[model samples]
Target: MTDIALVRVTFDTAAEADRIARHAIGERLAACVNIDRPCTSIFRWRDVVETAEEVTATFKTTITLASALAERIAALHRYDQPVIESWPVAVDTAVAQWIDDATHA
Candidate 1:
């Protein structure tokens, strides 16, 4: 069975996002990566509240590869605590097959 998943991550800069995306593709961790424009993120770090501009990237991969993709992203990320999440998505059969074919566990 083919299962599709989306791995979402945020980076400090666009370059970082691109770098990670390239690495993921090269390593067969993700089928495709969509890099979004800069977005403002607000959160609390430690004892203080903070806000910063970040670039978000969504990795199209298979359910089997989602964990490995997230691990790779964390290893290559520069942030002390990077936002890396994976969610199962219901996609068309064709898309699910495509992702499964592209991603390697």
Candidate 2:
């Protein structure tokens, strides 16, 4: 098994999600990005409660690339404060190797 970084982000549109995914993969920041189903999010921003439909994205990359991946996502995100989070994850040997290959360039 290998340790990798699992990054999760939300976008207002599928286009936005796809754009981020493409950029991450193109830049070798992430090995793969899995676009998940749309979800409803409720939060408080600027003293106002807001609700919106959001698309979730899951990114796979080496732990070493997590910071850069998050930075890239923030740069490409449209939201004033995009939701970007990552944590270390353990994966099967083959999957880990694949991630390293995909992100290490």
Q: Which residue pairs overlap in candidate 2's backbone?
A: none
lDDT of each: 0.91, 0.95
Model 1 C-alpha lDDT per residue in residues 1-105, reported as the tens digit of each score: 445889999999999999999999999989999999999999999989999999999999988889988999999999998989889989889988777777755
Cα deviation at 46, candidate 2, in Å, is 0.6
Regions of model 2 farther than 4 Å from truth? none
Q: Which tens-of-lDDT digit does each residue in 1-105 have in candidate 2? A: 779999999999999999999999999999999998899999999999999999999999999999999999999999999989999998999999999999875
Candidate 2: residue 38 Cα off by (Å): 0.9
What C-alpha lDDT does candidate 1 achieve relative to the native structure? 0.91
TM-score of each: 0.94, 0.97
lDDT of 1 at 3: 57
